[model samples]
Target: MNNKPYQRSELIYKDKIKKIKDSNIIIFGLGGVGSVAAESISRNFIKNLTIVDYDIYEVSNLNRQLYSNYDNIGKKKVDVLKENIKKHCKDTNIVARGEKVTDSNIEGFFNINYDYVIDAVDDVKAKLAIIKYCRDNNIPVVSCMGTGNRINPQMLTIDDIFKTFNCPLAKKMRKELKRLGILSLDTVFSKEKPVETVDKKLGSTSFVPGSAGLLLASYVINKIAFEE
Candidate 1:
């Protein structure tokens, strides 16, 4: 086990670095947001990770996905991210599941005793299910909302779902979560109004999604390193 890889983090965290290494983290979705979040967590000395994603890298994903590039455009996102994480954090134990997390299979995915679960999946049904499952089970979860259709990285902030606004996705999530009796959740959301696009397709940039992922990573890492 080469602790040298996280030497700088070890300085501030001291022996608490071991706590991070022992953490069991699961991230759903390996697109622009989840890919960066997974990479950031792995580099921070998280040893165990279960990454779930069924998508393949397309040329279009190169704009924001950390594991997407021209060379791996046709490859599976979970496999690509697992290989990349292993290359950097040799001691980390990463399990890549190339499958989508839906209501039908959600129970199987959360069977393991994960210390942290990141809900980066965009589907409203899946996202709400994961969040409700975590809340009901008393698990720590951080959800990312609407990194697309925006340009400002500064507008991204971490807060409960009900406290977020200006992003359409967050607004919808707030209503859904409230109906489910879930009053609070840690979420990364942008306060910027989405840009008007003629085609009505979500417009995204390289930085917006990347920044949201980083913020989610930082939030999780800090909680593990300090709060734990």
Candidate 2:
């Protein structure tokens, strides 16, 4: 077991600290949002983490991704993220899956029995597959909706997907999830109207994605630590 990472958190959460340490969490997507969420969870002494992402970090990702600094631009995302986590939280057990999640392969992804699932992938197909699988299995999950083309960190909030608005990604997801009969979902999303970007490339700022990631991590931590 790893030593408690936050002395102040242990002081307030008390025995919930141990509960956190004992819990297993699996986070999908190692991009701007997922990277920060995964690191935040590790910092809280959650010893077991499963990180999944198929892409390699690119120069463009440095603007928003935590693990995508210039020094490691071409590295596979999950591999670099795993090494970064071990560098900081050495005792935390990390399982890095460097592959995309699809309905065909989703069954293999969930074999670990995670206590919570964080969905941060931008791909709609993969995102829905994860959400549906978690919902069907009765696992707790929090998903992130569209962090791109936005600039306001304060607009972020966690709510059921049906209640979400203003985020175009959330709107599409709401329709698809409803079609699949997945009535409700917990997610972190922004209410800021998306800004138009030059040349059709998505525009994102550091704070928005970073805040969404941390908020998702906070929700998971609170759910496991204080909720039944």
Highest lDDT against the true fold, candidate: 2
Q: lDDT tens digits, residues 28-51, model 1? A: 888889998998898886768899
Candidate 2 C-alpha lDDT tens digits along 85-129: 888787788999999999989989887779999999999999999
Name the 10 consecutive residues with the lowest summed lDDT in model 1.
103-112
Q: How far is 157's C-alpha from truth in model 1 (Å)?
A: 0.5
Model 2 TM-score relative to the real fold: 0.96
> How well does candidate 1 score on lDDT at residue 10?
88
Which regions of candidate 2 deviate over 4 angstroms? 1-4
* Cα lDDT, all candidates: 0.88, 0.90
lDDT of 1: 0.88
* Residue 107 lDDT, candidate 1, scale 0-100: 82
